[model samples]
Target: MSLEQDVATARQALEALDRACASVTKHVGETVDARRLRGDLSRVRDDLDLMAGQQSYSAYEPFAGVYGDGDDEGFGGAGRTGR
Candidate 1:
């Protein structure tokens, strides 16, 4: 696959990661026990933020694969193949 496609996939992953972080933050605010997720959330947020930094148009190394295997049941919960 082309580097452009990899970069695009990484960008999409970064966006989804950001949305997940926001959701976690909202949940934390609504819960009384923020300490429970303090560590996990911090790590995940940092990882996502770091991953986003590698999506540059001129980035050399390819980003980690974002697409799942062809047998991924996550596509539509019906074991859909590649999209």
Candidate 2:
């Protein structure tokens, strides 16, 4: 897919994640696993924060490389080269 498409998809995913997190939050006092849900919500929020950053959205790939650790060297290369 194109970079624009990737951005749209990521935006949609972020929105969905936000909605799910909100729903979970609404159940804070009613659910037994509220703590677990809160943790999940936090994790999702962290991911959303990452997605909103330039580095995370720089390419279209799903997994990011560890720059300092040299683990993601070849995983990225101009996300949209042709168009």
TM-score of each: 0.35, 0.35
TM-score of 1: 0.35
The C-alpha local distance difference test score for the whole of candidate 1 amounts to: 0.57
lDDT of each: 0.57, 0.61
Question: In candidate 1, what are the lDDT values of residues 1-83, reduced to their tens digit?
Answer: 67656657766876686677667778558454554555555555455445556433333335335444434446566646665
Clashes of each: 0, 0
lDDT of candidate model 2 versus the reference: 0.61
Candidate 2 ranges with C-alpha deviation above 4 Å: 29-83
Candidate 2 C-alpha error for residue 75, in Å: 48
Error of 2 at 23 (Å): 0.4
RMSD of each: 14.1, 14.0
